[model samples]
Target: MPPPGQDPRWETMGLVHDYLAAEFPLINKTLSLAKVNTYGLIYEWTGTNSSLKPYILAAHQDVVPVNPETVSTWTHPPYSGFFDGESIWGRGASDDKASLTAIMLTLETLIQKDWTPERTIVLAFGFDEEASGIYGAKYLGKALEETYGRDAFAFIVDEGGGFKDVYETIFATPGVAEKGHADIKLEVTSPGGHSSVPPVHTTIGYLASLITEFEKNPYPVELARDTVPYDNLVCMAAHSRDIPRSLKRAIFRSGHSNAALHRFEKDFVLQDKFYSSLVGTTQAVDIISGGVKSNALPESAFAIINHRINTLSFVNETAARDTQTITSLAESLGLTLKAFGEDVIPESFYATSHCSSQSSSTSSSKGHIELSLAFNHELEPAPRTPTSGKESKPWDFLSGTIKATYYSHRAQGIKTETTATDGDNVDFDPRNVDGNTDTKYYWNLTRHIFRYNHKNAAYGSEIATGVHTVNENIPLDHYLEIIRFFTTLNNECR
Candidate 1:
């Protein structure tokens, strides 16, 4: 690919495709494999022939469009592919471009080093992943099942994991499961009337009151804390049992006494600001409208409150549906409810059809597991009890990966535990489940779904900044760290 001489967006896709598919062969592949607007382009690289099954390594090539004028805001050119001493800079530097570069650079280096593993390593670059990968990865995944049985992949690596911090230090965390998206829009309407002859409360007034009420205390459903974060944290803290112990103790004791007041306050705030928000239900009012104009006295005001649940259920978790229920309870007094954008609710069209939820450690899954899901796939909340699938099993695969790579850096030979990063008590604060990508696609399949990114490094609060904003930035050092992660992963991929 050209070394960022020109803005890559125009010819960038073609160049990337050529490099991965034709030029270096591995690095430059397909620009749009699916070839459909929804599917986007793709590039694939096959590993050297070997008896072992292949591993699917994925990263999307399509980047979020940048502001044409302010592109210079990038310290290093977004597409320069330049490695500054401080850090490599670019758009998608952290969100996913870093991940993409990692695999690309790893393969380029490995191929040059004349290294070939026992398994066929499949490196895929999707063109349209920035839009949730419906076409790129999803379509490729379908093709894989058709070509090889469902179990063809030993494992697949997507942008689920990234480097983060446990305390003030950098902690490399891998995502095992991401919360699913359940969008709920609570719309409240009241009798529309003129400002001159108001009915005590307008629709906007009523909806605002309902929102105020919901805000008093979010729905209190529990989230299943995926064992992965805890494992990473324990490892990050060097297995210091004291930290988590103190944190957990605080969670329990905060409710009981004033004696532990200070301890509880400090600990609760940290936990709430750090880990608790990741796995939970969250709500926010993004839009609302009721009146048409001034003077004439319009009727009807509506509040559109968006909600996402951290429940085990696939895409569109509890809060999306529960918003209505919450509104219903508050409506009898005179408020009306209506949710807009319900039509845009995500539909799951595919499932891990070949794999079985019943597979045991020793069980072999069917050759192919892909199923079609309807657009309006309203999944029932999974059993309150957690369920595990071989595809989505949170176990040594995750913990082992982290341990093998970064563990050696540690002084102690401590072992780490792995579990799905689900919401055990998500509803406690609805913020965790807001209409966000954290758990959107995860709710649909039983595969491992983890939501993590590098930006959290700067935000001491560990809150997600709803992706794509003017201030979107990640540390250059962290960007390099993620690149190194791919280096470690490829070296250790089993």
Candidate 2:
């Protein structure tokens, strides 16, 4: 990846537009290509049917920056588009460029075939999805809403969930919803002093104690069948060939025995990292800062705690509750706390002891703390995409196409368990995207938003494509499957 300052959004898109203009003139003639927010690209392909709603397929143009110090550790240069007959190695190979390439090629093929759908199709490539996506998807979503009425699309697909062979079952998870997100700022203040004399606790120390409290008390553990994780588990248990009979029974009897289902999920199912994140809100103390001088005692300290709100929460409500929880804890410790940069603390902080904020919290410290809490960069989780019966056309088309493309490997006597990345049986697994995507900004534009790409693999597991990590690569076979999936989607959706 290029340096953050040097790389400009839409540079790649400009090249792509030029290439398409020269090689595929028909595309320019048939589809309207325009840039939104000066960088985000939207290519619209008008269809014959004015009555049918549009569809959108999206991918991001950016990849995470690679550290200069770690460049030498790479077997091949991070930006080198190296193909060793089996896979393509590069920073964005699997993260998003794969989808961008696959989508472009699929659209080109459709143009060559002169096939037009009855419904309109949109290809949206966001510029800053790796960052906050504020200028990219945010502006694009608003523009789309203004141009087309609210809930204008039949379905919108973006990158999030993917296919994986978990527990011997080839599960194709389509991210039906995403976790909300917020970065809460925790700042502690104190009177400064020389190194010679220090108070009983400094700002850092108080922050540390607050952090400890947060660690001691995690969010309450309660998994309902409605949550994406449990729902996905139930789907897997039903579809997989050899799940244990007891587990199958527990899932089947979930209506009668909710306790048994919850126990089974907590004790057995959530052992996987991917499944664990889906169950509840998560918090990580990502950034912290304190004194600049080594000789002087620090007077002030600050920290940013990033929170991923579970499907159960709205971002603002979650942040408010966490802030109040911290205030209560601070009061218990004989310290005063203010929130959102206010001078006077809320009266409710003293009168109420409610803890409806069932969201995860984190903190850090150097000494005794008094501080103000503030939240920024917040977004509530997306509306859940429908996957059941009548309104499941998008789900059916996507899952059915995936099955048709990948299940043939199984029919050819290929064992899915041969390797982690080899599975492609494509069972429908509707799960929440633990991380936010560009689709998060488009929630108002469409009720049917699915965060999915057929070849996406859960990271940290053996099958991962190394997204945002060192030595990122995409297998040629998996890349082909992506093209096939999109091609199938274009043909079948009509």
Q: For each candidate, what TM-score against the reference?
A: 0.63, 0.86
- Name the candidate that leads on lDDT: 2
- True-vs-predicted CA distance for residue 337, candidate 1, Å: 5.4
1-494, model 1: which lDDT tens digit per residue? 21222434445566765565554554443211433233334343445555656666666777777677866665545556565554444566555666666667677777677765545666555665665555455565555555556556555566654443334344444444444443334444334445788655555565566667667766543322343323333243443223566655644453455655445444443346445444445556676665687743434444544444454444433534444445434433422222333322111211222224433344331111111122332333222212235433333444445544443322233322211123211000001222223123223232433333222242242222213533234445455445455566666654
User: Per-residue lDDT for 166-273 in model 2, tens only?
Assistant: 666767778898888877787777778886787787778877877776666555545676777678767877888668888788778774686776776677656656
Q: Name the Cα RMSD for model 2.
A: 6.4
Candidate 2, poorest ten consecutive residues by summed lDDT = 358-367
Candidate 2 displacement at residue 48 in angstroms = 1.7
Per-candidate Cα lDDT values, in order, are: 0.45, 0.73
The residue-level lDDT of candidate 1 at 160 comes to: 54
